[model samples]
Target: MYTQCPDCRTVFSLDASVLAHARGAVICGNCETLFDALDTLAEQLPPEPFRLLPGHTRSEEAPKLEVAIYRPREDVPVAVAEAPAAPAFTPGFVQDRRAARKLPRRWPWVVTCLSLALLLAAQVAWAKRDVLISDPTIGAWLRQACISLGCRLPLVRDVHRLHLVARDVQAHPSVPGALMISATVRNDAPFTQPYPVVSLTLSDADGHRLAMRRLHPSEYLDDAAVLRAGLAPGASAALLIEVADPGNRAVAFEFGFE
Candidate 1:
C-alpha cells in the first residue's frame, strides 16, 4: 500500500499492518506535518482484459495488492486589489460651473441690442432736425454738429426775420417802355441765413395779377458771394429789379421774399 502526504504531496510505501496500526493517521516524512492517510486514499480495480479461469487446478498464490497514492494539485491563493473611489458630485457646484460658462454667451446679444438702439436714436434725431433747431440749446448743438461735418443747415422760412424797405419804381430813362425798380431786403436773425427767393407780382387796375416772377439765389446773387456765403446776421442786401411795364392799365406791383 502507498500513501501520500497532504501537506508536501510526497509519496511513501507502507505495509497493510502499518496502516492498520496507525489507523489511517501518519505524519509527513518530508514536511513533518500530521494528516489522516484515509483522507488521501484511492481504491483501484484490475485491468479489464485479465480474468480468472473457472475450473483450473492451480496451487494457491498470494494476493497481489497494488496501491496508487493520488495527490491533488494545490490551489494557489490570489490577492484581489480594490479599486479607487470616485468623487461624489454636488448639484450646486455643477450648476454654478454651467452658469459661468453660459454668461459669456449673452454678450453678443447685448452688443447687438445696443447697436440697434444707437441706430434708432440717430434716425429719430434726423427726422426731428427741424423741431430740434427751433430751440436755442438744440440749435446750438446742431450748429456745432454741422460745423464738425463741414456742412450747413438751411435757413428757416420765417418771414418775421426779414423786412422790406426803400422800395421805388420809375420809368427807365435809357430803355423806353421798361421800368427800373429797387428795394432793400434785410435780415434780423441772430445767426447768418441763406439768401431768400424773391417773388414779384404785377397787378392791373382791376386787382388781377398780370405778371409774376420768382428769382432764385443763383440767379440774383451776382456778387462774389457763393451760396455758402450766406447773409450775415442783422445785414441787408440791395435788390436792383428791372422789368417791362405791363401797360398803362397796370397800376400796382408787389415784391416779397417767398
Candidate 2:
C-alpha cells in the first residue's frame, strides 16, 4: 500500500485523488527529501490527461508503480565491525623477565680474580731486579732472602774487615719493606778494579742471620777513576768505613756485601 520515494528511498502513500496540476512537489517525511511528482509520475504514467475522481480524496494505498534503481560503483556492508579469535598460548611467556627472580643465584668469582691479579703484579715487580734491605732489626730476616740470591758488590777493600754494622729496612708504599744495611768494607785489597765490590757477613749473638748490605765503591763513587784506585800494585790505601742502617734496626745485624 506504500510507494517507495524515487529520490529518498522512503516508503510513502497518497490516497486516490484528482490531480489538477501537472507539476507539484512533495517532501518525504522519513528522509526529509523534496521530489517532483510531475517528472517522476510522467516517467511512470502513459502520457494520460488529468484525472479527476468523484471526490477530492487521496487513496490510502498508492497505485502500482515501476521505478528504476541506481546503484553506486562502490562496495558497502550492513554490519558495523567484527572481532578476531583469541590465541592458544599465553600473552607474554616468551620474553617476560618478571619470573627470573624465581631462579637460583650464582657465585661471583670476580673478587678472588682481582686479588690474584694484584698479587701476581707485585711478584713480577719484585722479581724484575735486586732488592734493597735497609732496616737493622728485621734486616737479619730479609738478609736471608738476599743471601739466598747470592748477590755481591764490587770490592773496594779487603782483609778489609767489617766492624759493628746496623742494617735498616723499609717497605715500599706499594710493596713490602726491605732491609738496607750499611757496614764498613775496609780497603785491604791493595789492587783494585774500576768495578770493585765489598764482601762480608754478620750474625746475631745466637749465630742467627741479621742484616746485610752491599757497598759498590765504584758504583757509588762520583770519581770515574775508582777502578784506578788500584793501590800502585802494592801500596795500601788506608780507608775508614762507617756503619749505619738507612732503614734502622732494633737489635741484631748481618753482614755480606757480595
Across 1-258, the per-residue lDDT of candidate 1 in tens digits comes to: 556676666766676777788787888889899877665453432354523212223348966768857869976555323554577777998989998987768788999999999999989977886667656788788888999999987665555677886788888878989987888888876656678888889898899999888888777677755556777667888887778988887788898776
User: RMSD in angstroms, all models?
Assistant: 27.5, 27.2
Tell me how many clashing residue pairs each candidate has: 0, 40
* Error at 209, model 1, angstroms: 3.6
Which of the numbered candidates is closest to the native, going by highest TM-score? 1
What does the lDDT read for residue 141 in candidate 1? Answer: 84
Q: CA lDDT of each candidate? A: 0.74, 0.43
Error of 1 at 3 (Å): 82
Model 1 residue 81 CA deviation in Å = 12
lDDT of 2 by residue, 122-185 (tens): 7874553223222234334554655688853222333333232333433333433433333333
